[model samples]
Target: MAKQKKGEKAAAGGLREQLRVPAGPVDLTTYDTRATPGFDGSKDDGKVALEGLGAEVSDWQERLFAEGRKGGERSVLLVLQGMDTSGKGGVIRHGAGLMDPQGLKITSFKAPTPAEKRRGFLWRIKQALPDEGMIGIFDRSHYEDVLIARVRNLVTPNVWNRRYDQINDFETELAAHGTTILKCYLHISPEEQRTRLEARLDDPTKYWKYNPGDVDERQLWPDYMDAYHAAIERCNTPEAPWYVIPSDRKWYRNWAVTTLLLETLRELNPEWPVPDFDVEKEKKRLAAT
Candidate 1:
């Protein structure tokens, strides 16, 4: 994998190779939250780099959407997992915002209702899956079942523990059925989260976005990190690899995820569907009419 020079795209597989977590024992402590791997640029450069990707990504997205509508089975599912204020929403707003809304199916998963809980953790997830030829973005995804459930003890240890295997199997099925899965764990430091939370509190307009519960959740940071380690370790597969995005800098986080999605779209390489009818004949018929 080549490195990404300032104001340039990464070498083929550069950022993806740099950020992808290899299968093995995982350590959250060892990963740096502030480091910008692959991207060697200043903040302004990073913002410009991200802006440059909008046109290409949107073009590829439309191609994929067209392919899907023309009996294509392929699609993409981007699963975003992060702690409070780690910028999942920011990535979506800035990254996926580049694509056409008609081609995107964005799902933000909240705490499950009693009925959802009864149906099982993945039931609602399946419901929100993108149709053929669409790009699906999950702000918070099924991994929450293991992460939050384990840390909060929302479910018994046995149930959440068993979900690790279930998730891998489910993703395998999805991959087999032409759904490309890209899971990103936005890794941000506790200090950065505090700063973001404080900034939100200091601004009157941001009060609507700030939640009192986020402060409470902050106390259990260690427990949540441990849960994340396990979930990434157990569920990280070739079919659905997890990328640990260093998210302390909001610009880099948004740029990195967007680049990864662009790469995945390029790999899919969806093209405009061919017209079934003879174009010259149709043109002639139309001209005569």
Candidate 2:
């Protein structure tokens, strides 16, 4: 596959190539999710993958907090978008579980309230943006305006069509404001989703997770795929590139997200700034006390 030029729309072939996953439903049986010598999420190698990822996150968190103390505010925003039963919840649970909770915020967006709908599609979303020195994770983000709304025909063609550019501008503004945006679309095959959905129905403990509406949504898989293709093509910008993560193997998905996040945070070079205080005066004050 040819490399997509910068600013060029990502074609279906290019996305599949970049993600390193087969074009259709993947057979999870062929791949190993267990921690091994090479794979990051293997449980057998003392869960080395998870431990290393956790350490990397901790280092970044320390730097970010130090920078925060110094009054240099840098923020990170992670957007996760995917189909129903695509392991978005699990990814949030395991992937973000290692990060410092005090420095991180997770917001899961559901259907908008009547008040929110009265505003703009992005009104509620922009309100959730991360503050400086914080990491914000969106379980389902603004992409829904383009994806589900398009799939379900909730909005007019012209309205949803305009959202592609709207989203790009919104993200670019975030990047300009010293917020690093990492967008990931958890790619899973229909079969994998079906299996997971079935597991939810069969287990009593997981039954609460099962929703009848999911079946209706699955029926429109083709529509969703088309919407996803268009949304990624239109909205993936140089400043905020979308990563299509192969999520059939939960371990791989976790490792990929964690690694990407660590690398992005490391690149920001978060550090503690110098305090504005007179050392001698402070010491004298302490002595007097």
Candidate 3:
């Protein structure tokens, strides 16, 4: 769990180091959507692996939560982003579901309200940050300002352009205050997305998850890619790094993210806080009663 040096190869095919967005330009095409990097397993194996993490991850999260409750300042923020049908919900359901809900703060961002726009994009985001010792999960996050906002012209070029620095500064501030930020771009191909969308429509149970607007957005995939490229290239820093999760295989995506969470928890190594009172005295008083 040692932090790898800048140029050093990650030990054990470390997913964080293996999947990290490299310095310089990013070409999404270069990353294979179906790849299950660092995992030499089939779909069923992936599922079992994820299931296997349920207890260990849950235990680590409880340690973190206990620490936070006992006045620890360290927290974790996991940012998830991708095109429609990239399985942001799936990750939460299969990965985060392994952990205690009390230890997690999950937010699913919708379009900004008129009131929110007045306050700014990050305003609501700041409010949702996890308390010390907790893990905060963003289903979609402030990067939307640079992603959807830019792609849709929600703001002027000059405005959106300046926000990247604002975003970086904000993340820096979060890191300075002990937030371990993990930004994941759930990488999925257009074809895979279409297939997923079609499945949603075909299954009556998933009808509510489908949206006609997603199709409209799909047509502009290339433009969104450009915006994502800029956002990742501009805002990717040592404090808040980006990891591209190859997401075509649902099982792999779920397992990989869960694995990343597990590794991060291991790296954090949050210990349960010790009792401040005299344990023997308290036990004796109870025994006497």
RMSD to the hidden true structure, all candidates: 2.0, 7.6, 3.9
At residue 213, give the lDDT of candidate 2.
93
Q: Name the lDDT of candidate 3.
A: 0.90
User: Which one is best on TM-score?
Assistant: 1
TM-score of candidate 3 on Cα atoms, chains taken together: 0.95
- Compute each candidate's TM-score over C-alphas: 0.97, 0.84, 0.95
- The digit string of per-residue lDDT tens for model 3 on 1-289 reads 3333222223574678888899889889899999878777777777777787788889889998888888889999999999999999999998999889988999999998999999988999998998898899999999999999999999999999999999999999999998999999999999999999999999999999999999999999999999999999998999999999999999989988887888888888998899988999999999999
Rank order (by TM-score, best first): 1, 3, 2
Which residue pairs come into collision in candidate 1?
none
Q: What do the candidate models score in CA lDDT, each in turn?
A: 0.92, 0.75, 0.90
lDDT per residue as tens, model 2, 78-147: 9998899777887778878888888888899998888997898999998998878888999999999888
Model 3 off-target regions past 4 Å? Answer: 1-13
lDDT for 207 in candidate 3 is 98
